[model samples]
Target: MPHPSCARRWAMPKKAKQADLKKLAICVGLGAAIWAIPAPAGVGLPAWRLLGIFLGTIAGIITQPLPLGAVAMMGLGAAQLTGILTFQAAFSAFANEIPWLIAIAFWLSGGFIRSGLGARIAYSIVSVFGKTTLGLTYSLTLAEALLAPAIPSVAARAGGLFLPLAKALCLACGSDPANGTEGKMGSYLMMTCFLSTTISSAMFITAMAANPLAVNLAAETLGYTISWGTWALSALAPGLVCLLLTPALMYVLYPPQVKDTPDAPAKAKEELKRLGPMSRDEKITAFALGLTVCLWIGGQSLGINAVAAALAGLSILLVTNVVTWEQCLSDNQAWDTLTWFAALIAMAAYLNKYGFISWFSDKVVGMVGGLGLSWQAAFGVVTALYFYSHYFFASGAAHIGAMYTAFVSVSIACGTPGIVAALALGQLSNVMGCLTTYGIGSAPPYYGTGYVPQAKWYQFGFIFSVIYLVVWVGVGSAWWKVLGLY
Candidate 1:
């Protein structure tokens, strides 16, 4: 007979399989229920059917009955097999530039980790400003902000890069979660770093994978084109303010027992000394990153597409062997993102193409118009609803794919300025991740550290969600006014 522990391990997979099957049943049931509804007067049957598939796919993504890519493939197949879309129409978005841009950027982002540049930068900042607990948290925040544009994956940036660093700092300070000493410094740092990732994600177009999806949706839905420079400039002031305030705010809300960490700087320096001089790969990665960023910011004026710029950057990395071709092929995240992103984009575009979005916008406008509120107030209501709805979403990409275009459409239909509506909703697509531990990609690792209890995590998440909205909407609007974005 097997040992008890071995038997328990064998039983675990069966239990997980049952759970997944239940979730999958929910997704299929939801889709079937929606499909049973008659198509609205102005919408085609195909459009309504695609909506069912799209929504079911979103539910699958959130609940994760299968891998994200598998969920997406199933949704796409459902649409095609049900005669809701042709094979060509189902896969056409794969040809779009947005998905390719994100995929290529993901490959480029890997160089930061592979070259040890990401760690080097984090340690260097810690060595400079890590004398106190607050300062140490700020250093991590700064590192995240600096790295966000280059590293598109928040999981990689936060979990792979900063999570380990934060844990190390905590260990160095004798604050192990295992020892009930997480309050010494671990909890505060973990919360701050996790929140900071969301803020930095809002700052740049390339900072998060879903950001480009939002950009694409805005262009398709609102006919508003937000360039890389526009996104960066619009977010610069508000993003910085959020980053600056987050560490301090967390320090106040979740004070560390260890207020002074005098040894942190020494530890960081020792880490730096161990890393020694920058390797050739690091220099190449740095050069490629700098060039890509400059091009992204100003390449439009030079008549270069942002996707072209990213492709160029990835080419440089491959040529220099900063990241090998084999490594790029092995980048499961990039390929997975490409697959799901393309499918969702195709589905969303077809929704608009078939006139469902316009029909839905009309229905929304009629309801909101009945309230006799001013356009500004209507938009505020819409924006608030959009931001808070993130609580129901696990992946930022799923949230963006499912709701961004519709919300932007409703906002514009309510007479909000198109650019203002698009940018506001776009920025919130990222910042909304601050509302829950499972709100986005980077949340799990930080929360899994056991530093902050689930209750405290949710509590701080709510507090910061409000704080983020005020900063991004209030301060961000003022900055946008100066830039004439409105």
Candidate 2:
């Protein structure tokens, strides 16, 4: 017989594997069953079939049946084999500029991590503004805002850059996530960083991958062109308000025991000294990052595409050896995100191509029309429903692709102004992401840091969602009136 310890260890993995297989089987079986059920006479086979696959995939993601990329691919493959989607259509998402932009941004972030440039910036800020716990939180918020305009992947920004620094800072302060000492300062910092990045992601068109995707959908659905400046201008007031208020609010709501951090600035300085001067790799990463930011900001005037600009920046990272080819290829998160995002983009595009979105929008318009409410009142109800629905989504891009067009169409049919409805829904795409940890790319990593418990995360998410809705929608509507958007 095997030794008892070895037997227990081996059995544990086997049991877990069995559980995973069972979940996968359940997901696949449910999808097939759904597909087998005939749709109502008016609904097209393609639309109904696609819905089945999409639901199954989402369930699989939530249920942990398989890796997200694997589940996404399985959905695509099922659609192709069932004749719901053509082979060419299934592969088209890989060609999408938005997903590739995200991938390139991920690669660039690797350069920042490997070269220590991201850490250097974080420490520098903390040293300057670490006199109090609230000051440190503000520094993190400021850092995230400064970097938001240039970095399209909030995962890379929050997960890759800010997370490491936040962890290090927590450790330096003698607060550990794993040892139940998180309430000292780690939880507060983690929550502050998470919320700050979420708000910052709305401040610029290029701040997060989902922003560009939202812009594309708006242009396609409404024939409204939203420039980078236009997106930034619209979000400036509301985004800054949320960003400024978040840290202070967290300070009041979840005050850390370690309110005094006077030694933190000195500690940061000492830590910087220990690391000595910046290296060649750091310099290269810094130069590439700066050049890329300038290019992205001015790309419209230069007639350069954002995706192409990111690719160019990636090439610079490669040539300078700030990040090795092996490192880039080995980044599982980047590749995994690319696969799932591409597959989702393809599926969403086909939904629009096949008239599903139009049908859905028509139904919604009918429902709202029957209510006899005025346009503003109707829009308020529609916006509330749309914003809260984010709790079901794991990706902001997916939410925007699925619901944004339909909601905007309904709002317009209800007599709301086109520009007002378009921009409101567009900005809320990022704002709703605050509703849950899985609501956006950056949320998962921040949650995975182990500082905040899941229940508290959810509780706090609800609290803050109400706060942001008031600020962004209430205050934002008034600001839009001033800008003559209505």
Candidate 3:
């Protein structure tokens, strides 16, 4: 080790400069200072500080200067307490549909995971395509993608299924969990699986409970007609493509390469052998899920809505003992996540109700209208609106609840196509996940697991956000136009 002075002179910029520590500290310090204020008014230095905090946060999120979730919650609490927003308004986020959907679905997914049912399902997927690493990765992704459009819970698919199986595979491959490639792979794959599931959750109406409301609002407010299959079809390309690439991307992101081990230990082999068959719970859960899909699609085609379809499946499960109320209630992360989601949705809706969003949006639109670049000006509004969304919402549904109608209505007034707006809004729901780890539509269970460090998670978020923004604005624009959505 070098002397303190010499080290200070030579050490940091190369190896120690991995993160913008000073910036993070400044933001955190200032954010905490604002948080300490009794009144969060936007009028004086406090107001200016609050504004700086807000702009700084957005800038940081765009630049990934820190953790998004921590920052979001801090902002939430501060804005409310400081009088910038009402407590009722701040707390109102808990009542939102998106949060409710996200939280409740986790319980639904948890029951499946806790009951050993999720494993049997994974084993089946692996049985079909677990020979090669790529095959296994794709197989897991396919299971997620296929179910993503219908299942409200992603944790069950990622944490419950993928993580466990990946771990088992690592163990089987002689990879030590104590440290190194195996552990990294497990962590990385788990993150990938979680992120993919969150993004994919935007693919269908039933994929998340908030979706129906989003669709309904768009329909009611903007006369947009978003059929279930049509919505899925619109999102499947981008969402699925993302899911397919995620495993490989994460593999690189984490960079873990350990070959499979020879075989299982004799004792472990015996245990595996004795693991003889899928548990009864597994059998029923699998059957129930399959039936749920059929009924969900067929029932909806028969004119049933996603909620009705979900309730129908849920009811049937409760009646059949597939998932009991006790089990559902016991799954803390599941329901908590949903409640959190609901709060977000409610808050967004409340913002609109209070004229907060409309006032802000009107001013923004007014400012852009003067530029006179018509389409480009319009794009600026869309992009700004999308960025603002993460500040308030934690998921796609929440974003939809907050701004779907407002954005669409304003777009139409500006001569943007309704179809274009719908697709843009839908895709924005998935894309926002990149802004922050917590901003992920389906992230609670993943985040709650304590694997992805809050800061690194935010880092991943910003990087992914750039990818999403470019993809949607640059590539998606042309695709939507060519597809006649414009």
TM-score of each: 0.66, 0.76, 0.66
Candidate 1 error regions (>4 Å): 1-19, 131-241, 245-261, 374-379, 385-467, 470-486
lDDT per model, in order?
A: 0.76, 0.74, 0.55
lDDT of 1 at 237: 92
Which pairs in model 2 have colliding backbones? none
lDDT tens string, model 1, 449-469? 568876788889899989988
> Of the candidates shown, which would achieve the greatest TM-score relative to the real structure?
2
lDDT by residue (1-486, candidate 2, tens digit) is 111121121122221223488888888888888789997566788987887787677667557566667878998999988999998998787986655656666677657655666556656776887778888888778988998887666765676457756765665566665457789988999988888887898888888778888788788867868899877887888888999899999999989889987787887888788768888887887788767666666776787766776667778888887667777676665676677767766776676666665576566667877898999899987888788867545567767877888898888888888877887888888878777656776676666555887667777888988898888878888888888788
Instruction: Give the least accurate 10-residue stretch of model 3, judged by summed lDDT.
Output: 1-10
| Residue 249 error, candidate 3, Å | 2.7
Candidate RMSDs in order:
8.0, 6.8, 10.0
Question: Candidate 3's residue-wise lDDT over 321-416, tens digit each?
Answer: 766787666554455445444444444444455545545555556665556667646865666566645765555655676667766766666777
